[model samples]
Target: MSAIGTRAGTGAAGWVLADSWTMTRRELAHWARQPVRIVVGLAFPVMLLLMFTYLVGGGRGVDGDHAEFLVPGMLALTMAFGLEATMLAVTQDLTKGVIDRFRAMPMFSGSVLVGRSVADMLQSVAALAVMTGVGYAVGWRWHNGLTAALGAVGLLLLLRFAMLWTGIQLAMVAGRPEMVQAVQILVWPVGFLSNVFAAPESMPGRLGAVVEWNPMSATVTAVRGLFGNPGGSGGSWAAAHAELLAVAWPVALIAVFFPLAVRRFARIGG
Candidate 1:
């Protein structure tokens, strides 16, 4: 009996994985059909990187190369912004009844969300590569070795994973494509409130404290440390232990939003 139950659990897991892959393929197909969307998604952050590196110029309290400071911050910003795309896609499916159509089939319900996340993560990787190339072109280089660079990448993607589910939960609640645009605007504040373009130390006292505690700030600081970039070190405890908060913040967010997104998705059409 125990053996039978174990096999049943394994089979259920396999079923979900297979269905999720199928849905992932369906999402990738949309990328082909709508190449402009993918291009725009990838390009926006690159444009921002160039704009800041050259046009805006100078980082307050940044000790060394501004590119060193800016590049990691931009990567974290890109991850924060990636949620808009996820939000838009989820709400579009919800509004157009695509999710409803999928629900009519025998596929696993949560697989749809899982598949969307996988496809979004793929785009995010591409975005990071593009941003990294652009950063290198603009004179940003990781002083750390390859393994540390990969660790930075892992943290960036972990933050993106957390943001992905947050977007999904928000999209499910928004329930319409047009509403997504309005809802997504809220992300910009969260992005800019961090110590992305400037050091938290440079800000006014209370505001600097707030910036230091930002989850995005934690990620930017942690990634900067891993990449051996400037602006990673800080006097504050938040700055001193950024790597921990980087992991913990995202885990906390996922712990809250992943289940919320799944629960909300389950209630659709019920």
Candidate 2:
């Protein structure tokens, strides 16, 4: 009986793992079918990189190459900006009764959300690769070597992971596909209010202070440090401890939103 029970538990765990992988493949298959989305996503950030580097020109108070500062900042912004796509996908699935169909089936609970996040993270990696390639092509170089570059990329993806769950939770709460645009509008302020495009020292005293404390700022600053880029002034505790905050901010976001997303995902049918 003991051996049978152990085997049964192992089989159940395997079933859950299989279900999660199947769901992840379903989302990946969508990417193969809709290649434009991947291209458009890659193009938008590269466009921003070009426009800002050329049109907006270099940032004030920046040290060394401006592209150095802009590239890392753009990478961080890229991570934050893509949440709308995930939210739209979630809401669309909910609204079209696809989620209902899954809920009715004998699948592993929470596998859908898991799968969505997995596919989105993979897409995030592809976006990061494209952005890094563009950065190199446009004269941005990582002076700190490969390990640091990889670490910087890891932090950016950590931000993306947090944003993924946050978007998922919001989409689940919003309940309809139409709410995508509204949630998207809210995302803009969060993205713009950060120290992505300029130095905190360059802005007004109070607004600069707020921007310094922004979560996106932490990740960008940390990445700049890892890449040996220059932009941070580093007077405030937030600026001085950017790497710490970069990890803390995203971990806190995941801590709060991951459970909320999972709970909310499970609650949709009830």
**TM-score versus the correct structure, for each prediction:** 0.92, 0.93
Tens digit of lDDT per residue, candidate 1, span 1-270? 445442344577788988899999989998999999888888899999988887777433433388888999999999998788899888888877576788897679999998899999999999999999999988899988999999999999999999999999998888878888897778888899998988887788998899999999999999999999988366899999999999999999999999999998988977
Candidate 2 error regions (>4 Å)? 1-10, 58-64
Looking at model 1, the pairs that clash are none
Q: Give the TM-score of candidate 2.
A: 0.93
Pick out the ten consecutive residues of candidate 2 with the lowest summed lDDT.
1-10
Candidate 1, residue 169: Cα displacement in angstroms equals 0.3
Model 2, span 154-252: residue lDDT tens: 999999999999889989889888888998888888888888887889889999999999999999999999999888675999999999999999999
